[model samples]
Target chain A: MVLVAIILSACAPGTPDEDSWRVDALRSIGDVSSSVSSVQLALQHHDRLFGPYLQTVAVQAEDAAGTASTKLSAVQPPEPYQGRSDTVTSALDDAESLLTDARIAVVRRDSAAYADLVRRLKRTGDRLSRIEDRIRALPDDRSRP
Target chain B: MKKLLNVALGVLTAIGGFVDIGDLVTNAQVGARFGLSLAWVTLLGVVGIIVFAEMSGRIAAVSGRATFDLVRERLGPAMGMANLLGSMGVTLLTYVAEIGGVALAFQLICGVDYLLLFPFVGALVWLVLWRAKFSVIENLFGLLGLALIVFVVALLKLGPDWSQLGHSAVSFQPPKPEAWSTWAYYAVALFGAAMTPYEVFFFSSGGVEEKWGVKDIGVMRTNVLLGFPLGGVLSVAIAACTYVVFNPLSASVDTLGQVGLPVAIALGKIGLAIALLGFVAATFGAACETGLSTGYSIAQYFGWQWGKFVRTDVAARFHLVLLLSTVIALGVLATGIDPVQVTEASVVFSALALPLTYFPILVVANDRDYMGEHVNGRVLNVLAMFFMVVLTVVALAAIPLMIWTRMGA
Candidate 1:
């Protein structure tokens, strides 16, 4: 019975308070941003890396971004932070989508497509960094822990 | 000259065998996040492992018994059983991680799913353990594992601001945007990866396997003292490489593929190829060691007559343990769980298991019945005592910190 309860608790959606919810969203954005940057860097070095290696990294980045997106999306934000939460999730969705496209380019060994994908990845990655900075600058609301 | 050559081989193997899957992943993760700030923990762990490894090696050489054997005899059955369970659980988890790591390394080369590669990697490791000679397993993989030195070359080639890296190495502070809890969590992980309990078990048992008598003590000390520190350097180089390429971009490293990116950027295709080879050799070699260790710990505890020096038919139960462990590891990896996550959990749990593993070695190393005149000297005793306290504290804090930091998130 105890084990079942523990498992259920773990599997249940996390309805974190506003402060902690923002923190989770921020972490998700940072993770996806980092993964996007990694894919971008790998794509830039396409000629220097083995095709399989490049494809593996791209797939890994896509998985990372996808996982981050899913995790943040699962969290139930406090009422006041719903709009902000949507913004974070939307940005994460964008990052994950871009990473999926990058993984495809890598698997297809579409070098010509990489230059364009690289541009989009950089823009998404920069947007993530900016979101991360904005979130980090938010005032602490430690009262709601 | 042959004696010198033996010492040289021992040292090189030590350096090559030092960075297993745990070290590679943890060091890279910590590096990409904190730069070299947590490097002191690795150094501390190296010294700690060196201290205990030297003790365990001496015990095996003088007593002609492995760690588990002495542990059972000296600590009594109940305590020994406790130690065995704790250490064995961690070693087995590490075995699973290493097998998964080997599969992941192959995945990078062939772009095959690591889950699809688990059985093949597990079978290959078991085949080596069953058929290969002990020295063959140790030397070939250890030498090939040297390819990881590419990380050091990559670090140098990246031409990082040495002074900045050196400052971070000494500062012991987490870079901003990271919590101290996370920093402490990775510190424990890094320490656990460095001084994994299995290294000592494998070292002492290998001593017994190699028939290290009193005469071989000098050579054993050379290997532990010289090789382990250099291996620790390879670990630091890995971290520095990630720091140079990933940290400034605020990029986190969560995959083996990201771990190799710095090398590709630094030295291009050739360097990345060598790095991949290093990953395969290191993880494969560690898989063999951890697999054998699972067998060694069980057989040593039960008095079942184990060692690679003996034929598999002669050590039937021991070989059986090895086979079962491989299957079990493969079974765990088959869950489609991420190997990197398994590696992370294993290292943290390794920290939690360290006290149970090392306390027995310390006790037996000081026992006059086991060591005779070869007992630990005054200076060595003080150092060992210090590490015992540190290991105990690390073990106590491991679970709580792991929970608090959410596996270093």
Candidate 2:
């Protein structure tokens, strides 16, 4: 309960130029959610060979990335990307749900379900990474006359 | 000579039974997270367990009453009931996790699904409780759990940078990328796992069941003081192995496989096999202890007969609770939850529930009416008071950290 409050209060209302940043944040969230799903799927198959090893790596990466996004979320919004903060927030919601689903699958031992969720999550991640990449490539609207 | 052997056996059982699934998982997790930075917590926990276990054993020796029995008489019904509920819940959840842990160990060794082994594991645990002699049950798994020494062996094989580990132990700072909240959270987990309530409940109750008297106090203290720190050594070895293997990579331990990975790396397949056996024996033994403890606390609270010293038909209700608790634990595991994760959560909850049990014990330990000459001295009193305060603060921080870290993410 307290965590939810912290996360909510930490998330400031999106500004105009924050659109691309928000998109990047949402995409990163999606990527992490997908990665968790993939690891969950691998674990479900009883493939002890590499499943746990992979999951360990994946979770570590996701945690690092999530921390980064949280930091990025604190930065000021850029111009031109202003109104899309809501879109980013909604994407974060989706990402959180995906991650939650992955956790549930792990607890339930539903490997098949985990695999399917991972595939969807990966696609979501790919889309987000692409969006993030595009945003990084975009010119600063603040400098635009 | 026979008496000497019995004492030796008793000490071994105490050590084997001391470190359960909770200790195994939490020690590994903390080792992976903080290296030896929080090793002090285990040392602190070892001292706490020894002090309380000795007090409980002494109380049972003097009064012929188990810990919970004294709890009810000392604290009255309302407060006793509250402690009973809290301790029983944490112990029972741990019981469930141990059952799962045993099955997971079987899965690792036999290449079969752990869920498939769950029923057999549950039945085997029940049978031991039903038919095995009290001393035999204590001696058998208690001695067999020595297989966990493989952890110590593995630690030797890994040959960690001793100076660095020593440095981390002395110069404690929360590791990089980890907030103080999370570091504090794992510390509470380690402390709670080491000083779990059931250990005291079982220790005191077992002393009474074995009919320990003043003469046995020496042996009991030996078991508490020596056996627990030895158990802590095993815990340190586990954490050290995990630290050497996982900490550098920034990997979190989420499964038993990860817990055993360091052993596997150090000692190869033989090491893995031994560690898995240790896991099974530790968890299986704990399943019996916690299963029995569930009944022990409740029956003692309500003034009912309990223990394997009595026949099944004699303590029907007590046996019924034992059977029911095992079944419920198995059912929870059958739902496919990771026993490792369940074990982690159980330890965390145990942290939350520590004070309820410890406070009453501290009070009872100080009471001359019960403890007589065995009552805590000034030094023991000061230490107990310090732990009580530490426990309270840890309990306060546990929930908030769990929330903030999303259960450590």
Q: Identify the leading candidate in terms of TM-score.
A: 1
lDDT of 1 by residue, B1-409 (tens): 9999999999999999999999999999999999999999999999999999999999989999999998888889999999999899999999999999999999999999898899999999999999999999888999899899999999999999999999999988899989999999999999999999999999999999999999999999999999999999999999999999999889989999999999999999999999999999999999999999999999999999898999789999999999999999988988888888989989988998898999889899989988999999999999988998999899878877776666787
Please give the distance, in angstroms, between residue B340's alpha carbon in candidate 1 and its true position after superposition: 0.6
Give Cα-based local distance difference scores for all models.
0.91, 0.75
- Shift in Å, residue A28, candidate 2: 10
- Candidate 1 Cα deviation (angstroms), residue B241: 0.3
Candidate that would win on DockQ: 1
Question: Runs in model 1 with CA error above 4 Å?
Answer: A1-14, A139-145
**What lDDT does model 1 reach?**
0.91
Worst 10 residues of 1 chain B by lDDT: B400-409
Residue range with the least summed lDDT across 10 consecutive positions in model 2 chain B: B249-258
What is candidate 1's CAPRI-style docking category based on DockQ? medium
TM-score of chain A for the candidates in order shown: 0.85, 0.53
What TM-score describes the B chain of model 1? 0.99
Clashing residue pairs for model 2 = A16-A81, A16-A82, A17-A78, A17-A79, A17-A82, A19-A81
lDDT of 2 by residue, B1-409 (tens): 9667767777777777777888888888788878889999999999988878888888889888898898889989999998998899899899988888888777656646677898899999988877877777666778878889899999999899999889888867777656687788888889889989998888888888888888888878877777788889999999998888767645556666567777766776666677777888888888888888898998899999888888889889888888898889888988878787798888888888889988998888889998888888999889888888988987777777666654554
